[model samples]
Target: MNGQPQWQPISMLPVFTDMIDGMLESSLEQLQNMQAVKDKPHVLDDSILGRVIALYSEQLQNHGAFQEQFNRWKKTGLCATDLAEVERLIQQLAKLKTANETILGIAKSISHATIDKIMAMDDAELAVAFLSGKLKRPI
Candidate 1:
């Protein structure tokens, strides 16, 4: 009723696949570099340094998992590792999408409802509105 309707968010596939690849590759390179440094003192000045490095690398490996999650999310609209997490993320994403559509529907309905309320006026009110050039043109 004012200007153009507000734009809605569409389900757009990500435009940059290279971005995801670059992010994961950079993350992995950083992890390996750190691991290499951590491994240097092992079997020489300190055994604990090596063991600690091993544990650290183990944690670093989980970053690859984030990339895996990104892949699953792109393919299935859900990013889940185990069945349980899959179910939960699917349910959450479903609820989120549903809520979005619901809000959009509400806005559309409200626009229609406002027009209906205007046209439901009694004969006298309609006459006065029309005579005063206040009635909207039918599209």
Candidate 2:
């Protein structure tokens, strides 16, 4: 696998744009395959399944958009309670591959920066920074 991306806080917005682009591109390919199947005759059950998949894909895109916006909003700084919620969302997201909500929360946290920023901080500093309006909103 490739190594991790280098830290570049200022480059975050562009990075997010690229990531979303990549995701949409890949998702479109998967969607095309799904549609090819749907083009065939199907019972109501299969159609329902296809619809569910479509909804999931749309949700994924929505999460991406929210993450970008969240990063932007975070620049306004977070309240203590809001920071706690973000943390909770992060923890919940880490354990699941498809937990889009959780993932989006965490992603939003680092949207304007890199994971290193979060990892380098002690809880107190992180909390203080978050509550002080020093952080940026992402997404």
Top model number, TM-score: 2
- Model 2 agreement with the true structure over 8-123: per-residue lDDT tens digits: 34335445445545555554554554444332322214335445445554565555344444444356466776555444433332322244433334333333333455456788
Q: Which parts of model 1 are misplaced by more than 4 Å?
A: 1-82, 112-139
Give all TM-scores, in the order shown: 0.25, 0.33
lDDT of 1 by residue, 1-139 (tens): 1234232121222322343334344444544443343322111222333343344344334334433453454456432343445444444434433343333333333332234445567889877765885554433
State how far residue 104 of model 2 sits from its true place (Å): 18
Give all candidates' CA lDDT scores: 0.40, 0.45
Candidate RMSDs in order: 27.7, 23.4
Candidate 2 is scored at a TM of 0.33
Clashes of each: 0, 18
Show the lowest summed lDDT stretch of 10 residues, model 1.
7-16
